[model samples]
Target: MPSPTHDALRTPAWTPPAGNTKPPLSSRMMRAAWRGLPARRYDVGWEPGLVVPAPDGSPLITDHYFPRAAGDFPTLLVRSPYGRGVPWSPMYGLLFAEQGFHVILQSCRGTGGSGGRFGLWRNEAADGRATVSWLREQPWFDGTLGTIGASYLGYVQWALAMDPPPELKAMVVQVGLHDPHAFFHANGALNLENALVSGVGMAYQHQGLAPMVKATLRLQRRLREITTARPLRGAQASVVGDVPWLDDAMTHADADDPHWLGTSMGQAAERLDVPTGLITGWHDALLDQTLEQYGRLRRAGCDTALLVGPWTHTSAFQRGWPEVFAESLAWLRAHLCDDPSGLRPTRVRVHTGGDESWRDLDDWPSSPAVTSWFPAPDGQLLQQAPTDAEPLASFRYDPADPTPSVGGPLLSRGAGPRDNGALEAREDVLTFTGPPLTEPVDVLGPVSARLSVSTDTGYADVFARLCDVDAQGRSTNVCDGLVRLRTTGQAPTRVTVPMSSTAHRFAAGHRIRWQISGGAHPRYARNPGTGASPVDATEFLPVRITVHADSELTLPRGAAGTVKDRGQPRS
Candidate 1:
């Protein structure tokens, strides 16, 4: 695995660091510096964006900024295709800039003020290299660097780190991708999170732009002509406008493609040498990817730290991230500035509900992590693990009814922070309960369900919810995950398979329940259970999918079980 050079990692170019506590510069100079330029006197004052030479004579270039105040200050680099001033860029500026560190926010080609067509992930390495090279030359740069951000911003950071820059000191990645394609197809099905991100980005891309022009741009003339005149003509075409490789990717969900292989952040971890800081929300749809990344880097002997919170993408965002932002700043100061003043850690700290307390740990998957099983008996998620003697819980999955989507982990325009109370009565869904624990159970880490399940047809869908059933019967969803069974890597006839992750603890008197069904429609496309292809194929089948719980869900029991599962106020 060849890595990009430390110099190449900071490509198209860099600018002087900005002065903190200084009065805001004129919008013209401010915008100019943001475009990777110094606020120097200009001839015509067009405010040229940063100009870094592309490795190849490709017309593509990047616009990046180095910190303003001083020479030789360590640098933090973030490359994103989204405009440089949006939340991705501003979020970092607010978080890292105040730490007395210089941060480089660069616009990827075809974005912000950079040049080039955008769509593929393969182009980042080259652009990242140009940005890094430019950062090293900046007079204010101390010649050391690190990378940080969430989602796409974080993806670019990871991509650059895999090919460490000589001065690439460290990284902090949140709920982003290691392998873009794998994230898109977690179980050989559609990557709901990726699809959502793509859609939201398109919506945000033109938010404040001219209304008429934005509306016109939303109409894809090329899309209507190229693959097909009408996207609705084929299922594959429908997802293309919003997905990275809509037509080709949807058609070959299970097929190994180059784009798929190249998206692997795990594979890239093999060549990694930088220390890393990881932050992920428990309810983040991409939380698993963050966990896998930290674990892989740790196993590879890279310095790594992790923090998992109850928040999801955009949920409890803004106000809540400063805590982790402070931690990242301290880490950079220690590693990049050689100032290890306050680095002692409480390790894994989780904010639990109920009492709103934080639990600390020495490590993630901390000591005393254990898993127990319960069977699905008479439609109840029985506490006893599964056995042949127990009758499996059965249900009919109707695509039309779609087991109405309740809140779990999501990142739509206005999702998360929802109560699952309304979904308890769907005929297609079943729930399991457990007696509350005598003592507080702090379960952190990824949760999985192991059970024997058989479907009436060739396909099935498993939706698991870990809720905090309060004394008053308010069932608040803490964390939940759904798996499309057809792509679950086993024979379709099997009765049980491992489902997705769940996070929540059963308070004494509260019961933990699992919902076995064929789908969580709208939130996710319902599996028809007919074994038809997911893309262009659409049909329905009533299948009796029984979850035999001799299988169990493995919860990440923290040393202190800091998982905060809270209850809603009773009506």
Candidate 2:
């Protein structure tokens, strides 16, 4: 057989085939949701278990693939904490290699076959730069490199790109956490459920128990028990054995602590100059961070494109969207192959949930209009801010019987958008509904609430959700947020909660709803109301929360006449 490195394997530059002039917002979803990867596109050659030395001489194992019909091609690199074979290899290594690109999948230090102690996000920067230097010395490497992957895999791309390597050309960053602190501390409270599960999962992964970790990742019932267990600090030991990092994370509640500064990629991300694409789901846990990353890159004059769908962190990887792969490849080609026509320098495409279609915008937050809704004493949501002091809406929050999590971006089973009817009916949760809308209201950006609340306990947590109430009174969540507060003084304090951004249309006759309460258990750690660390708080204090009537919820809306029926522009 001819050597796989033969000039014949050198394929012509790839170009995105021309499609509709005005492309559908979700052409990928419209196509059969891709199951697994399509059969290999080009004849491919794979070399497994190739070891490269890091600067410190620690070994990083990689699997390399190149088209059998081969010529030198721009290489695509995927550096992941996951093993470099099986799962990640098939999706990225083999799939991209067969598509006429040189692909390399390297296991990050301390996981897979790589040598070095795993320090989670802290180790990627140095390891990534070392891998790039190794790639440069490869016979097939053409000095052009592009990176792709989602979640942690995607995060490594940004972590390395913070100080862009000259060989690095573009990246497809999907659902990645930019701030290490945000993963543990969201809005000043421990994101207990996700942090514990994720930390445990990582511990198991390093121990070579990959199958077991995947099998139990979504154990919602077990996770609930773990989060609600007494002595929160030691609860995880019962789940995945001892993980010292979990204990440290719980104790260091402040995100700005110097210890966490080393892992933050946000500062480095601002200095990036590479062409980039961001892919995230409306209900993905990292939606907020993804959006924030895009804004930062765009402001820094980096070329960027954004695509958001109605999927979860796990589902997005399982169900491949055609546009996601096509556009991502196009993006890589444009920058890595000296071809810039594959995608516009800046474009935003978001899938509006209820309408179930895509809308292309010149920029994000296409909403030129901002709408504010206020809470009324009578369980009503009013368009105008209240002029009088209405009676406070009170709810008793007992950590022992804390509100269960139901949808809207979670790290576990009940993630994504789900009905809030069951949750809304709970006495601990206070629901405020608006009258039927005269016309459809298109909400397309960040959702936030400024709640004036007073609690009887010294400390408490406030969880808020933005939902759409249909004509039939069915409530489905759109976005939500939570914050831990100190309520010792008995004075009403304003807690500003920032929910994930969304692109959804509240149809005529549908009502806007805000479900406010003390906590979203397991999703966020239940506040013990004693100003103690969530992990060590075994004493539970029932908090009586009084939400002032004038508290406000804000939704970003499209400018009058900007949003059209079916998401198309109306002349």
Candidate 3:
């Protein structure tokens, strides 16, 4: 493979045609829908299909959007594999251009007519550098550059940070991913549903809306059959049409596996000096990755800001776009344009669940108090630890009848908080509930479950979830985690399951609940008790999992008092 810039060709920037400079009707409608988006300061002009040479001399197709006004503006680069049309053209290209930015929206390798095969994360760094080099030679390039996008687009930004150009000044990573390994195999378990959803999107989304929709429908129609395949490895290829990248991701479960080396851009966060604005939702699939990068950036003393909403991966771009757009625009203006007036005073802003309100804090986890609730044999969550050693609460997990996944932090549309009443009614699920809270309790940090567990079959998975039980007894999942276990037969092992992080409140009259299950099927691949790879397992076995009375759920409690209201977020 030739280096991305090994024989880079200088390409002339396409001049925008002198035509109507008014915002398109679609752009106007989108702007209207996002109530708090920055006012459009200039009409936009677009120059499409500008060719930039990738490092290996492949043509990376790009589109340029600039203000129709007569003034220089900082450029914002948004490279995506998910096509350069529809939402991308309007949301990032037009919107940012109208806000006085010269937006360069490009298609990644092997997508949207760009030359070369898409090698997932492999081609981003060099392609990004080559694009920047091309930008430097453009007449409209003002030398100041910023990158912005969500999901895979965010991954490209991190890849660019690996060898950041001097012109790169700021970045906005929304629900982005930095580690492919963690995204696919979190806690040694395959994130099956997300993997499939992502695979479908990557394979077909850039092709066009119709193909993407058709592929999505096909996957949905065959989802059950695909997920339940005895040997899971080849099932995905049948649905997505031979996606080698997805296959490779599913095969490598170990982070240290040679296949995943250099795939993580976490080091970029730790060393990046550019001003970065991070955005995510409590229910977003990449929530943990966003928080992880925030911590790393903060520790490195990098200028960073974080915004977390009450949204899932897709909803963040829809319902949460107003706040998301405002935050991004403010951060960009502050850093790139040297205009900090719109920036918030605090570094962190998060929306608290239950209350459905936003709060600004000096730092994440603004509270230091931790509360532990022990699970008793009587299915109660008690503040005090148990003294008596009682028989363990037990449930059987059958791979043939895996516990179905409910709404949570998933990439699919079926993600976010959902009523778990039906799921908890299953025999394989265990729930421990605490008394109704007289005063609302705010939990604003990491949530975890510590378990003393044993399994008859030696191999199993422990899925722990935290929920808020409302007055009507509807249980809504807040955060959850799963750990694949390999233990000695019947010997209890103590393990701590990090159930992600959340900013939620247990409202008055609401009860706190801790749910324990063997596994959340399809969300995570079912564990076969024969010590076989889930992808290649030919045999399914039932395992009896037991939880001891000593197990506890730990929650970070915010300070007692009303969290200062940050006012209603626009839209």
Candidate 4:
């Protein structure tokens, strides 16, 4: 009988209009921003080193830049743990200031020149309210306040959004995390790489270390060695120096633990009523979290807009997309300054890969056509469910020889989507490849998989990745997930894992591939398979992992051809 893998390329390719990318800022905008603006109505004024008292009476440092020609202008507040004197201060301070708004760049407690112990988001809620109260006391206050920033800075906005101040008007949060557990421990496994890198980085910043020293410590090789060390609980102290939070985080694996609960937005997500704008990248580590925030705000009846692009966290920061930037500026103007020029027609805007185009949607999974794809014994993916009832493919997983971390949604090093050729070649990795697609398959929403697996070990972790295999045979990861199994009886266990969401088009002639492995070490700490704590486990237990033939991958498919904004699915 002819194999299912041979029946490839049966559908036609779907092509869409390419997105518009603006060139660098014009000389007019740059020159005017540097020197006093002549054509604009307001000139920028910079005021540095102002102190605001937190609720606990700790002094928080702030710098203000307001339009010289301002008359009761609204203000934009950015609370960041990173120093305020950096370029971010002047960039937004001058831009928004010249745009006729007051910009206050304040360092969170324990960062920059601020005089308080920084404990991540612990002090943010109380400190944020206290700062807003201080803003209201100012003679220049106009009762309209907005928040803006990305990453950690973005996180502060969400902290306040849970219980916003009376004077708050709008917010623009980019790539922020709503849940600490999702950010730190994804799917019951410690995101060892990010946790270690970020912990050491914050420690270095807190100690005011030299930039070169910080860079050397952030080196990938050094990070890999540290992450691969035995017992992750206290191994990072040598590099990071007594981070209680990191230690506590490693020990508390459960998301419901009170330690993790203190950092979560929880019911605050539903209480938020501010007009909000969200920005994220397809490869951003917090992409899923960002998307969840948008959905929650929308459901809570808040005016919200979402922008997603084909970039990584670092890329989005260093070389931001002009379209997204322009949209953000417009969002701020509309919500804070009451200017409606930047209003977007569609609430959700996603940049689809493959064709390199932008797609507007009403909501996520815009009319999804979910398709269930099954695996064959010979490493082929079929559209229909398999009939076999036995284990067709099996691999031996050794904690000592755990699969190395590769490109995906990681932080510091090896972050974002990358080719999986080398990773897929490992004996421990089992792949189910589909034949070249005849037509483009637009996958634009949540992706998940259900695996019928049996393992000899007491505990194991399953890592799954969805990839697009081009005609050249390069397998680039689209989305992936991890699920840790602590205990499973001898019988085959059925486990479901949800992968990251994305809007990508697998073009005609490209193949859809799925890779399964016991672990993506360092990205997630490897399970020792001994039912012992991974932190101190010293044994190298090799377990036989059997993936039953009936395992299935569920993909949320969008309209097949020429997708447009709010249009009917193509027949």
Candidate 5:
């Protein structure tokens, strides 16, 4: 783990031979794929495998990409644990470098031939400060800096923002995570699927392409067996190898637990004054976190912009990359290079579902109106509250046959919108359908459900989902939320579930549907009726849940009179 000598660090592993070279084929292909990108202004040159010392003197492997043309430019630092090859090099290093900025792509400690053990978020702050110290000594250093990245890369940026370097001028966090506890255990339930997927990626992706592919295949093959194991605690090791971090993450479900101290970087956003841009998808697994930071940054009187697309966590890098890249490039140029020509006029931009079109606004919601819909006894959703005194709907939820998850927000390829007809047909799921809409309903901002429920067992969970039912009766989920329940007696207890936010349209002739269930298995660890943590539970029990007529669903109405009061439910 010895740091390389200063003389050796100055030597590049590989560099361009002559002047005015053409951009790499990979860069050209990516530019073509990401159509409408700014024209490449300069050819890119890279010095790979340069050694930078971490705070503890561990050698952190790094790559430096710069424009071959002769002009000084601001530096963009991108730290990642996913290695510095394939997508990282072409997507962040060469592509940005060709646009006339110096790009530093460094593999986080212990991930890609770097010294020191990777302990999740433990070393990012110290390592990032050390990297900045190294940057200051370079002969080419120009004293200006910007940070940009997504996911854990975004976390690293926040780590640095804890004590932001003076040279740092701007930041762009895409589908970023500011709170690890919120990411893993939001709503008092473990996000089992996302956790497992993350564990696999962290443990294998840095190894190389072949090893990563093999591990992904194995995960896909054994996911069911692993998720449904009796004692779910150690079952994940079979698929993701020995991941001590994953075990620790799963074991500590409480956000207030001592194990989570110093893990959250949310305070950085609350007090930050750096001009920042945030991007995420309506269906991204980390959507809530991105939105949370955006609000905090705004409250702090910091300059910030927000963009939300109709995509999942992974798609934001693939099919959604064009928008993601354009947003990032514009923010970096405007803030770091003092070029605002590429910037859009609006502070908030979002992609609305159903129509699948983008909208630009001064800010989110645009002062929307709130509407309430009440569930009736006969599987009906009525705008007016029911007059019946004791109307009730009930269903039995058996952990052995837990309700299956069908799309919505997730990290796997199965993320985003999907047909939920099969899922709605289950006996354990209760659906209340509204009459067909005579006009399109434009919904924006937060969605929530206030439910009055009673369960046979004191320990349970309530999952609420909003869906759009087409003419063919196919239900597609829009947004959903789950909250764990603990009650003392048979009397119904009222609890409000935050279904997150959305910008969507329900077309004319389509009906709105409210789905209520005990749980969405795998997406959330199944709640055992015995009140034991799902990871350690060996016994499963069935619980009967009852929803009262007083339950209501609330949505933010983007347009006035968009929803017509059609008389009765069709289903």
Candidate 6:
């Protein structure tokens, strides 16, 4: 009998085969972004240090710029904590310049020669609103405005969108978080490690030339170490929990807190009436935040368009994804530059790996996209629904012997789409497999779960991964999610894990699999079974978890979906 591990590429998604790459650019590769696209130099006015008063009149500084002959060029303002001069995407200097945008990159207060104290997103909308007021007063001003960027830059974009100015026309938000409270403290659990790392980066970044100089020397030394083939592994420990994060995630985890609630994008999406384009990677750790924001934007009929790809937190910066930049330019053109091709899609567009095509869908999933459950006997997964009523399955979540991270939407480092091969049989994981499918299936939107369980330790977490198991037995973790087990059975534990909304085909003979465990660390801080204080609470909760198929994962399924967009599934 042939083992079920002979042909894993059973139904490979749109990922170009293993060795394909972008056609070489006519431009230089990987050297530097300084050699940017040509910028039509129009004299831009910089009235440095003109203070824009905050809501209560707190002094805030802003920088304004536009085309020399700008009769009504849309204003593109990016109020970022990062310095204005050090181009985030060096190509933007050229890209936007050529696109006829008045890109104004201003360092937020307490950053890059700006005035006033910096208070993260808490003060973003006010500052952004103030800046817009300043821009309108400019000689070359266009009443319409749009902004763009990722992460922090994207965060501010959402903030501004919450209470947009009349001139605030549109935006492009990439990998931005939905709720800062949840981002800092995931699922009510504080991530001290992540908080520390960010805090350290901020402390170093805010330091003037002195620390920067020393950091440069250290980087050079690290570079030397790299060239010498010496690895600097686990250096992140030094910078974890480095800022006011303890207060953000620890002291402010409560949903009622003004600060925490104010940061949520759900509320913002409700008020944002302008057209928006959102792009994010499926494998990103912050995917939930972006996904939640997308759902709200669409549901609110906010004229928002969403695009998710098989990417990581920084997938946009990687080599194989220049198409994203082109798409982004189009998005901006539609919403910002008013171009025809930049028009928003009829529905969501996703790059499904298994199906190997871009899929356009009507609304997210209105029905069960694919229905299958884990056959629990002795850990070996049966890629089909469970007929026999097994009461429970078990796995040991040992923090010390963590499941080696795989490629997917995680923030930690990995080569490509992290394959979950190294973690399949860990005694601590509950694995389930589906028999080879005779037909193709389409999975869109959220992948939900309804598991029946009883735990002694007051708290537990369910980690579910939906993957494509090739004939060769390689289990590639396509998409997975986590939830607090305590919230199950007691209340509405109907948490929807962010699925990589794509059209994948588990061809005849290809298997579908799910790996259930306690955690996927680093990407998400491990949930110690104990619901003790997330910070300074070190005890693990031990509990009994029972998974019932009646309460199985609810997916947004559609049969071999019809092609509606340019990126249609390969029939």
Q: For residues 387-489, could you state the per-residue lDDT of candidate 5 as single tens digits?
A: 7535389999999999999898898867888899999989999999999999998888989999999888888899999999999988999999999989778
Query: After superposing candidate 5, which stretches have Cα over 4 Å from the reference?
Result: 1-34, 388-391, 559-571
lDDT of each: 0.57, 0.76, 0.89, 0.76, 0.86, 0.57
For model 3, state the Cα shift of residue 15 in Å. 9.4
**TM per prediction:** 0.80, 0.89, 0.95, 0.89, 0.93, 0.78
> Candidate 4's residue-wise lDDT over 1-571, tens digit each?
1112222321222121133221123422543445322244565666677899998888999888777652567789988876764345545666667677788888888888788788876988888899987876666666678888877778788888878877787888887776777788888788887787667655555334376266445555466566667765687776677778778877788888888767887456676888889998888888988988887887898888988877676566545534555667789889877798768678888878777777878776587579888889689998978777588798998888889878877666567778889999999999999989999898888889999898887578989999999999999999999998754766788899888888888999999998999999878888888877788777768888888887999999775333444322110
Residues forming the 10-long window of minimal summed lDDT in candidate 3: 1-10
Across 11-116, the per-residue lDDT of candidate 1 in tens digits comes to 3334443332331234224334343222332111111245665565443433333334333455677776555554544455433554455666666665565666
Give per-residue lDDT, candidate 1, residue 339: 83
lDDT value, residue 150 of candidate 3: 96
Clashing pairs in 2: 9-69, 9-70, 9-71, 10-70, 10-71, 233-535
Worst 10 residues of 6 by lDDT: 224-233
Model 5 lDDT, full chain set = 0.86
Candidate 5 C-alpha error for residue 515, in Å: 0.5
Best by lDDT: 3
| Higher-lDDT candidate of 2 and 5 | 5
By TM-score, the candidates rank as: 3, 5, 2, 4, 1, 6
Which candidate number maximizes TM-score?
3
Candidate 2 lDDT by residue in tens digits, 1-571? 1123333443344332233122122322332244534455665566767898877888988877677654557788888776664456556655676666888888888788688877777878778898887776666766678899877887788788878788787888877877878878887788877787677556655344456455366444477667778887777776666667677777688877877877778875577888888988888888888999988988888888998877777666655345567667778777777666767443887778776666778788776578899998678898888885454789899988988888767666678878888888899999889999999888889889998888887688889899999998899999989988886577788779887788888999999999998888778888888777777887888889989876899999853223222543110
Task: Assess the local accuracy of residue 266 in candidate 2 as a C-alpha lDDT between 0 and 100.
Answer: 81
Give the better candidate number (3 or 4) by lDDT: 3
